[model samples]
Target: MNLSANNLCLSVDGVDHLENVTATFQPGRLHTVIGRTMAGKTTLLRVLAGLEKADSGSLTREGTDFLNIPVWRRNTAMVYQQFINYPHLNVFHNVAFPLKRAGLPRQEIQRRVRRSLASVGLADFEKRKPSQLSGGQQQRVAIARALARGTGILLLDEPLANLDYKLREQLRDEFKTLFSDQGDTIVIYTTTEPAEAMMLGDVVLVMHEGRILQTGTPQEVYERPATITVASIINDPPMNIFAGRIVGGQVTVAGFQATHVSAHLSDLPDGAYQFGLRATDVSLASTGVEGEVTFVEISGSETFVHVAVGESPFVVQVEGIHDVALGDLVKLRLRPDRLFAFDEKGTLMQTPSYGLASVEGR
Candidate 1:
């Protein structure tokens, strides 16, 4: 079955929650929605589950109207950012509640409950209550309960957002295996993380300010971001953008010619362009494009040095800790060959590399 949404619009208090959002979701593929907070990821999921009504839209499942169906009758299950469980019910009962409410036979409920719990690695925790379980286990119970329904559509809205780093990582790894075997199910998972979206998604939808900016496979979205907004959203610290110019086959940025682009990007007309480069592709140099260090962040083994070139911000992500201080004048070596060219209106003009970006996952 395929689920389709066309011209879905919702507004409240003069703010658009969704702006003409349209997409098709096919069964047996996991579609990940990635965006910042208040980007309408939750709203989109709620509308699909028949929990929220759209101001204007058409929702169909296999060519039949889906918006007409009540929330209770829709074959959909949703897990939220918060772990929701019956306070008084143990793990097994929490998973079996929906099955029981559906008036399934006792044997059938027991069989489904057991398998669901096992699928989420909670088979031995059946007798434990949510209060007695850790945060990760509690969320697993919520996931198991959702899986027990065997719904056609499964929506997970940042289900691991609240977990600790280690727990989140652990569960994120387990989720790939758990959901891989789901038959004919349309799974829509939303997150604010680029890594999570890339690692788990069969198709990734990038959203911003209530509109879907771009949609493609992880590699497609990363290597060939459709617009400037998409390139910024899909990167961790965001790709560094600079106003540049190509004159006589030489690319110049901040009054410095970085590379002679006649070979790689030769066909472009001489004019103003926006260039994008990943922080990882930049490095500290003794004599290169100069900038003032504005901020320095040491994250584990990597150090992110934020520098200001003129009025523009540049980030250099390097392995190992560096002796970078604020207000320090630093030189940066921008890999001009890795630059992405964009038009003045923020639309993509060209990508640097098709295969290289995929290997490095920029």
Candidate 2:
């Protein structure tokens, strides 16, 4: 069954939680909603699950009204950030709880429980309680329980958020295989991490301030962000944006002008524009745009230096650690082919050409 939401709006205590949101989900696909905190990801999911009613909207499942359905009868399952499993029940019984409540035959429940446990790599731990398993193992039990019932729609809200670094990585890899080949199931996952969204989602939805900003495939969204907000949200450490203008085939910022025109952007009409560049695409050079180093971050084998050039801020990512200190003057060299041009209103205009032909933004 396909699910669709249209013009959903919700507000509580004079604050808007959701605003004019519309999207359609098809079966056999995983959709990952990416946004920062309070972007209404949870609110939208609850509305779809019949947990929260939208103030003004229409929800339909294959053209039938979905809001009238009770939450328990919606045939949906949700996994929270916390590993939710019955503390007193063993792994086997915990996964069998929903099937038992639904009045499935004893033999059928056993068959499904075993299959689900094995799918999540928790078959050996069915005899253990939640407390006996480690954090990642416990989450595996929760995931198994959610999938065991054969629900039509599955919602996972950052299921690995509480796990350690190594555990998160391990589960992320596991999730890639677990969620694949979920026949006729529409899976929706919400997360704050861009990497998580891009890695797992068949289609990516970027949200902000209770609104859906952009929706596309992972490659489309990453390569062609609709707005400056999306470009920032889709990249780690966010994309660096600054005010500048292209005049007579020359690109100049408001202050500390140094870079030349981008080869792909030089043909565009002269006007004030915003440029978005990834941290990795920029570097420190002696004969380029100058700025004052405001912050330095040493992350593993890479160093990220934050610099303030005129009124624009930029983060330059370089290999290995560098001894960059605060208040240090530095020169930044930006790749001409890696810049994303935007209009004054922050809408994307033209994308850089790495290999694909640069196209005009919508």
Candidate 3:
């Protein structure tokens, strides 16, 4: 089922929650909405699920008006950040509740309950109450419940946010695989984490302050963020931005000149601009731009070195272990092709292109 929202506007008690928000969710695809706290992620999801009404605009499913439909009749299932399960009900009944509500046969309900439970790794705990399960387990039960509902639309509002890091990672993969083959369901997932959005979303919508700033495939948005705000929210460690200027066909910043300029930047008229670089695009080398390593973080599989160059601080993500220590002087090297140039107004200036060469070192 195709879901579309047109010019959705909502406000409560004089505070605007959704402002002209519009988007279409295609059937069988997982759409992700990402934003910070109170950015209207929840409000938009509620509007889509029919839990909250939009003061203006319309929602439709294949030309059928959805706003006029009651919440229970919308045929949508939602899972929130907080675990929602009946403490009085055992795992089996909790997963079976939705099926039973639909008045399915006893054997079919049991079969689906077991299948959904196993999908979320809760098959062996059917007899246990939610109170007896760990927080992650309980959340899985909630997910299982949603899955068993067999709805055409699934709305998830940061459903995995409350789980531990390890479990979140595991469930992320599971959810991706589990939903990939569901060609008839339209899943809308909201997350504060960009990595989660990138991993799960076939289409990502970046939201801020009740507005969607950009919409595209994960790779398109990540590689070519439309504005600084989108870039800031779409990166895990965050993009490093520096004030600089274009001079003599080169970009200059922090007393270092970048010779490998993208051809799309030729029309910028040499002046003030902002430069963006991702941590993964930088590396510590024997000789390059110099910086002082102020902090070091070792995460078993990788290391993140926080370095200070002049008055600006930059982070470099390195694979595995490194010999660098705090307070060590290090040389930083950047891949020019990986750099992004934005105008002083925070709008991305460089057009999408490939195979750009770095001019000989300056």
Instruction: Find the candidate with the highest lDDT and give its number.
Output: 1
Model 3, span 85-124: residue lDDT tens: 9999999999898888899999999988998888888889
Note the residue pairs that clash in candidate 1. Answer: none
Report, for every candidate in turn, its global Cα lDDT versus the true structure: 0.90, 0.88, 0.88
Instruction: Supply the TM-score for candidate 2.
Output: 0.95
TM-score of 3: 0.90
* Evaluation by lDDT, superior candidate among 1 and 2: 1
Q: Name the runs in model 3 displaced over 4 angstroms.
A: 260-268, 291-295, 321-330, 351-360
Ranking by lDDT: 1, 2, 3
Global Cα lDDT for candidate 3: 0.88
CA deviation > 4 Å runs, candidate 1 = 354-362
Compute the lDDT for candidate 2.
Answer: 0.88
Model 2 has a clash total of 0
Tens-place lDDT per residue, model 1, 1-362, is 89999999999899999999999998988899999999999999999999899999899997788989999988999999999999899999999999999999999999999999999999999999899999999999999989999999999999999999889888888987777778899999999999899888989999998899899999999999999899999999899999989888788876557436734567889999998989988889887778899999998899999999997799899999999899999988777668888999999998886344321111
TM-score of each: 0.96, 0.95, 0.90
lDDT of 3 at 338: 63
